[model samples]
Target: MNSSDAVDIATDALVVIAKISAPFLLVVLAIGLIVGLMQSVTQLQEPTLSFVPKLIGAAVVIALAGPWMLDELVGFAHELYQRTPQLLEG
Candidate 1:
């Protein structure tokens, strides 16, 4: 309802987002680096090489971590719901 409340919600949202995304993002980054180096060494410039591997890597990671991700998201949502009254009162 106030600037402080807005700021609080935004910061919480960002923090949760970072937590949820950091692991998968790190995996993708590492895979991308490895793929890039492989491409550089092999001198095989296939346009689809990067896209397929990265897509598969992300899909696997998301599939493996989906439950944990859901749990964290649900927890964050619950916390936000619980805080709604306090935010509104302010």
Candidate 2:
């Protein structure tokens, strides 16, 4: 309804997005570092070497956290829905 409310919604949405993305991002970053280290140790400088591990790591993170993430998203959606009328009134 106003700039402050809009800003609050945007901030909340960004926080949720960061929370949801952090695990996968961290997993991929870790896997990438490990793969890079291994590549350096073996001296096989293959660019694609990092992709599979990072992808797999991200996939595993998604598999492990998918349900919880979905629940969080759904809860946020519900909250937005519940607050819709109030926001409209404001």
- Top of the candidates by TM-score: 2
Model 1 TM-score on a 0 to 1 scale:
0.89
Could you estimate the TM-score for every candidate? 0.89, 0.95
Candidate 1 per-residue C-alpha lDDT over 1-90 given as tens digits, one digit per residue, 9 for 90 to 100: 899888988998898899889878988898889998999999988877888888898899899988898998899899989998988787
All candidates' lDDT scores? Answer: 0.88, 0.88
- Cα lDDT for residue 17, model 1? 92
| Per-residue lDDT of model 2, residues 1-90, tens digit only | 788888988888888899899999888888888889999999999998788888889889889999988988998889888878989998
